[model samples]
Target: MDVTQVLRMNGGDGDYSYSNNSLLQRKVISMTKPIIEEALTKLYCAMNFPKTLVMADLGCSSGPNTLLVASEIIKSIDKIRLELGHDKPPEIQLYLNDLPNNDFNTIFHSVSTLQKIITNPSCYFCGVPGSFYTRLFLNKSIYFVHSSYSLMWLSQVPEMAISNKRNIYMSKTSPPSVIRAYYEQFQRDFSTFLKCRAEEMVSGGRMVLTLLGRQSDDPCSKECCYIWDLLAETLNDMVVEGLIDEEKLDSFNIPQYTPSHNEINNEVKKDGSFIVDHLEVSEVKWDACTGYNHNLSEKDTQGYNMGKCMRAVAEPLVLNHFGESVVEEVFTRYTNVIKNRMSIEDTKLVNVTVSMTRKG
Candidate 1:
């Protein structure tokens, strides 16, 4: 699906307005800042001489978190300058990239707000809007690349998997053919992404990417939760109730692209463009319950709203089979299901961040 088509189908900016709320965005920024800082330090160490550095945040959505990455990079550069006792700061260029349909208005406004707070004279900022899976940066030009909560989205799912005879992904049981198709597509997209980055990044440059991932090597294992199923079922329910077209529900399929750690490593190794430096997986716990209800205690509401808001933003893709009028209702049902599931004490989500360095 085209990014712009998806955004337009969901009411564009109106559907995405909630993403800019400060309270919701802080959670993402807090989780992501340290990862970016560590990557920047490594990149700085790898640089042979001080020159203008180009950094891009691929798939950076419209929110405070987008600018937070830029701010953290600038701060790390300043820290390096201070430690080296240099009179002038290092020249830096920052690129904030997302799909063409992203809320650039909010992003530009956030950039304006950030400019007032950042006093560095050598920093330059620009927005590069496009799909990362296709092409993002100029060839052999980027010095550092960072993408979080992106890359997991494939350009599109394979056609064979959606056929009626197969119907593998739609089934509740873990179908081997379906799982293999998904893995193959992920490998293709990820390899393309790495090859493109390999062409764009300078030798010895560093890249850090973080996204929602599963821990299992087995493709059919339940360890990886397919979130689209929940949304699909929700839309299916609406169809049964005559709220949506059954044919639309039948025709729609979730866009596939979640790779296990082993899958990612194998693809990276096969590409032979980047050396894997760090691979870490952390189980992130989120309170989906606190988001829909403001009556919950502030202390209990520790960034659950951010996850909820992300779910809301992604609901369009999940509910694309349904009519636009039922979009909100479908998301409400999905959120309620998530909240109920999260009520269990052991419920949590897993997030993985992988860092790679360009081979010289």
Candidate 2:
């Protein structure tokens, strides 16, 4: 499966679309707001009062939170400019980037909405469609970059792990070779991302990246990757019931890797282009919202809510591999499996938020 083609949040503003089901993502954006505010404020203060500021939001899935991020940054810059005794806002060339198949139309149509969000309304919105694994802008064009919950995805599944049948990601039962392959892919992809961004960003440019990550040092730690384990088990159940072929399940693996905090710092150090300003680990519960809420409610069971949340992100991949008919059943089983075994405590998905700046 083409990760770039199929890996997108559920489209549109409908009930099941990412915009509707992205409360968890919104919570994450909110959780990182302080860091964003501080970083942008500092960046503005550090720079000369230029007339235009170039900014890009990578992996900006079409959702309500997309423009909200831009608006928040605009507000930060406004306050900073006021403090610096500038009466006018800088012209911001705001770029929202995602995979090509992502619902760019939905985000593109929201430019009018953006005018209302920013204080000065001086930002020019541009939708740049592509993967963040490669460069999207001219050399030294961007002044600030932001990505959240998106960098966990690799550019592709590790080719060497094709023999890793019956597992979509590293599991407790996975062989050492399989584990190394996933780690190495993340290293390569992340290093390339930094190298490209280093060229695209001006000297002293800023980047704030928030992604799913492992809390433990071990890449194979269960806490870091238990969600995929439950997902694989759900597919295994379907295989037993003849709903999906085992070979199909084996062939399909999520092109995602959640690295440890140490690994993230190491990548920045290895890239030698950016200096890490701050790196933090924040734990978010699996059932972060109503659909994935821990307690079973009268309207939606824990399984049902978790199923919907999982569907929002995984539906595209599931549709490509198992067909549309199997999507609902698989997530139903996914939710049931989680409800039956994993408790509330096991649901913490660690988020690593790192703030960095290009070295002069």
Candidate 3:
């Protein structure tokens, strides 16, 4: 199947929209706010308050986080202008980018609200639809770039990944070949990303990228795919229940990679377009965004909360692969699997924050 054509966060504000299930992503964005503000602050100070601030947020899905981030950026710029007592803040030209199928209508609807929130009346918002692996704007047009929890997705599933049977992501049990395939895909995708941004950004422009990544250098570490492993087991259960064909399950592998610091730094060095200013690896609990519910059992709470987050981000790809009928069964099964593992207190996902500056 064509991964690019099918990959999207569930659209709209309905039950299945990524707008509803994106608590985890929103948490990650909140976690990185200070870093984002710091990066943009440094850029403004370094550039001596350029007259026009051109910024882009790649893979910006339609939701609260979308405008929240852009609004935060505009707010920062206005704050800097106030602190420095400049005659005026730069004209903020903001670009929100995502795939063609993203729920852009939802985002565009908030343009006026976003403008009203910004301290500066000059902030302008525009939605650019396309993949980030290619050029999305003119050369040196952007002065700052931000992407959150999005770079880990590969442009396409690797042909070699078909060997990772019955699993939707890389796991410890995956063969050496399967692991290498994932690493190579990440390398290619990230390198290409740097190349594109290098041309699109000004010489001193700053970029901050937050990816779901791991602390360990081992690509096979459970840190990378343990939750996915739980989901895989649920799929197996469905197959046993005659709800799904085992053959159908084997063909699906999610095109995502959780890279380690070493892998990310390696690609940045090879790309030679940016100097890495900061790289931090932090841990976030699996239930960080899943608030406690007194009405349900621990199992149900864990299952339902995690299920919503997973279903929101995963429904599009899963729906395309398994079709409409099985969507309910698969995620319901996935939730039960989460509930079964409620005793594992150490479950957390690693978040990587990398900030860089474009080289001359």
Q: Which candidate's TM-score is highest? A: 3
What TM-score would candidate 2 get against the native? Answer: 0.94
- The per-residue C-alpha lDDT of model 1 at residue 249 equals 61
**TM-score: the better of candidates 2 and 3:** 3
Is candidate 2 or 3 superior in lDDT?
A: 3
Error of 1 at 344 (Å): 2.8
Each prediction's TM-score versus the true structure: 0.86, 0.94, 0.96
Q: How many angstroms is residue 305 displaced in model 2 relative to the true structure, after the best TM-score fit? A: 2.9
Looking at model 1, report the run of 10 residues with the lowest lDDT sum: 7-16
| Model 2 Cα lDDT, one tens digit per residue, 96-129 | 9999999989987887888975688678889999
Residue lDDT tens for model 1, 70-92:
88878877887677677677788
| CA lDDT of each prediction against the hidden true structure | 0.67, 0.85, 0.85
Which parts of model 2 are misplaced by more than 4 Å? 291-303, 341-346
* Better candidate number, 1 or 3, judged by lDDT: 3
Candidate that beats the other on TM-score, 1 or 3, i.e. the better one = 3
Candidate numbers, best lDDT first, in rank order: 3, 2, 1
Residue 236's lDDT within candidate 2 is 85
Q: Model 3: per-residue lDDT, tens digit, 1-360?
A: 786689899888996677866777888888888888888888999998899989999999988889878887888788777888887878989999999998899999878787776778888888998999998999989999999988998999867834677777787777778888888888888988999999999989999999999998887677878888888888778888988888888888889999988888989999999999999898887776575778987656765787778888888888898899999988887777776665555778999999999998
